[model samples]
Target: MKRRAFFLKAGLAGLVVGNQGLTSCAPGPKLYGDKNFYINKGYQAIPKLKLSKDRIIKETVGLRPFRESGPRVEKEMLNNKTIVHNYGHGGSGWSLSWGTGNQARNLVKTTDAKKVALLGCGTVGIATATLLQESGYDVTIYAKDVPPNVTSNLATGTWSPSSRVCAEEKATPEIKANWEDACRFSFRRMQMSLGLNDIIDWGDEYTVRKQKPSGSNISGGHEMFHIDGLNPEWKTLAQKDHPFKADYVRRRSNMIFNIPSYLNFHLNNFLIRGGKLVIKDIKSLEDIDALSEKVVVNCMGLGAKAIFNDEELYPISGQLSCLVPQTEINYKLATDGAYFITRKDGIYLGGSGIERSWDTTPNRQLTEKWVDVLSDLMKDMKG
Candidate 1:
């Protein structure tokens, strides 16, 4: 698990020569012996992160709302109200917010209601509200918690569209098409927001390895590149040019979010657009019926599990630990299960995705375990 298991879980390792002989295991490959790969031979090594327990200013957990058939973006009738379910995005919520928000807006347009009610003020909720408001609908967001306090604030904030969104077995052709639409829209929207300072920025991330990656992508999910309009700027870095843990490296462009700043920007935009937020904990469908608006957009994240009684909805609980800011590094790294992204707020590091865990409080043991693993990883990296 020290390396092989980590890479496998991260979907970075392509395949392995086990008893089965060259069976595929993961999606990415850093297969060695390629001298023509593009890497900055003089690349400066990323400084080791301060991962001590005390360096963790705050520890937060998020329940990534996951459904086997992708997110529930359909509409239904509940107590004379048109309910648009927009939850269950799993780990792709932040990444797909705008696109799914667009879908929810389109659904809302079909309804006669002008005053739209958005449930759950997480990333999805705020994004939906903004879109609806801009579309000339009066929108209100009701939730027990708001951003910086919600699960969206705890996101790793990387623009990855298909991370555990749906199992490959469940993704049909139609679903794949929907995924492509959502991913493209979301990615384009992010591109439009690129000049927003620390709120959203393009990042250069490295997926480093000691051995070259081999085989094709075995981890099945929607591939954005398959979508006609999308083109990725991924490059293969040769070992000589690679700086960290080198044998080979994969460099790609990632749309990163400074969670706090990004959340603030959205909240501020929603508010500026005449949006209203009411603190409410909706326990049942009956509670939804009590709302003033006839059309309700549900963006409740894991809260939908209880409200909608969606058996398919489950939590992939994730935890993140941060270190003090460092300006010497401007890039991010992904290896094993851990990923590191530097933000103006702090340098975020995390790698815990426990399925079906509802615990929100930080686990000291798990936090230390992630820090230790990352610390060891950094130590093992070559200059």
Candidate 2:
């Protein structure tokens, strides 16, 4: 819509005043399927303005950066080279990049080396190099794209790291522990970056539920989330002030990151910290190991499958359509298969449960379909 309709569909705007005072036209998110889904809590909630206008201007989509199981946070090699692999963070990389990097850096704790070579310039690489520099090690980042162009910038990142973790991730107790630690550590770290707009801040994200949602709607499958109890760094909505009891809502001051802003922050500060970026393509593990100096962290995201030959590290394939920005609202909403939110640039919307859909190409028709569903949802929102 004008950005208002977009933000409303994205759960950024709450119930509005209509011909009747607080009647059937109160703002709420659309419900597609019947399930126990929570409000997305990704948008900045907006109250109905008595003396102003509303807007909904943009639409966008992004992949969840899927990888099987927990991110690869170990050290391995090909041709006897020390390769500290650190990629495979399906959708939670932006939220947990530095925490995982901290874990990856710990692997090289006893090494007396003062310089480290890192592969990839995405969030993982940048975070790893940043941590290394903090630890007195000179780090050089190697990759094809840096910052704004990297997959990291494509993310509508927040504090919940394991939001899209694969079903197979909860297998081992130790691995589960690692997952929990990463989630907790990451959430805490994000809170620390609040002073700067680039890295992190507390924004409102709302999720609206329908009485009975259907296919292509919110799945409500995440009834029970297991982790180190790392709830989004936001506040939870209480029942007394809730909009719809049939569709429960929660609010919080969770971490909401503006990708471009933070990516620029990293790019501007990397070299000042003595961090170097080497732009090149590494076809094989040998190329990566040969390029770096002492230690190597592989935050390849989806690229891990090819570079490391990881058959399990497959793409979860997600798409988001972007539109203009609406600062009046700032929250994120997640339903069955669709999610909506307003960031710095455009209002973000998503709906994709197609397992193994390799069609990375952004189809304009598919985007319109997703947007249509969102609009239909608004038409069907409850009081």
Candidate 3:
């Protein structure tokens, strides 16, 4: 009895010692060559990457700077070094990174500038900047706001971009071919990681379908649904197991992302590899043309309307109500013009499409409405 008691006491002492040193010894040296490596053996994902990786994804919010016409990714009105315009990605910036970034990157291969200047620091700008930096050019991001500060982070990103690309008239087959390349490329890039890149994820996408919804026919730059078609560029929703939102609720091959994870990973990657950022509200071309003499990557997003004077640019605002997270609600839904997504600590509930709702302010009325509607849906789920 005494021997067992002594051994138990010794084991308890060892466990206490191990735990006691955790705080002081945590965040230890690099392991197995991965810079942010650690030996956390049985560590479960506590809550969400948003809180755990706070240093990487500094902030969260949303904005709108899309173009009425498809993404303007070709050389625009410019001078000096070769400028590959890569902005106005609408809602699919992360979803179209490699695909679109490659298009812009292709325009500059023949004329490799010593340095590159990317205008915005949102997803579109960051992806463009990162690709350029990776290709051995000194890259600088000039923007009024940076990651966690920009609108890209504000969105509850899904893998669907309805009118993100403009109509057939605006985005010619040639430009669309470039756009397709951007899509496939971005998808491929996501394939490279082991799931730590939170800004993007591979999961089932469920948009509650009612009827074959028509996309925005008029070009006021507003879009609501991208939830049909077989073999969609990303993936299509499943029509087999339909939901009440429509006659069919299709399960598609798609993404459910935590934007914070995406921002922090790339932001850290950029900083680690020696990239520069300047926070400047560029009022004119003269300001940028005067600041850095590098070949500029015009990833201005919606800023091009004034700075680049492209009237095709417009706004499409999206709003979501955040509820406490429930893992059971792992899937996402789009029913009766509303969307419900289960992200980290919150279940994003929303669906508001006021044509001229350019305001980014949260709508309390809309929030209340969605909450009531969602509560009814929850009951329906039970019924």
Against the true structure, whose TM-score is highest? 1
- Cα lDDT for residue 123, candidate 3: 73
Candidate 2 on 306-377: residue-level lDDT in tens? 777788776666666675565555666664446765677767666664555666676666666656665555
Off by over 4 Å in 1: 1-54, 212-231, 380-383
Judge candidate 1 at residue 190 and give its lDDT: 80
The RMSD of every model to the true structure, in order and in angstroms, is 16.7, 12.8, 11.8
When sorted by lDDT, best at the front, the candidate numbers are 1, 2, 3
Ranking of all candidate structures by their TM-score, best first: 1, 2, 3
| Residue range with the least summed lDDT across 10 consecutive positions in model 3 | 44-53
Candidate 1 lDDT, 71-150, residue by residue in tens: 88999999789999888888888888999899988998898899998998888888888889999998888999876688
Number of the predicted model whose lDDT against the real structure is largest: 1
Cα lDDT tens digits for candidate 3, 4-121: 9999999999999998898578897553532222212333111211111112211222555666566777875355555678877676666776668777877766574677778877
Cα deviation of 311 in candidate 3 (Å)? 1.1
Candidate 2: list runs displaced more than 4 Å: 1-65, 212-229, 232-246, 379-383
Please estimate how well model 1 matches the true structure, expressed as its whole-model Cα lDDT: 0.77
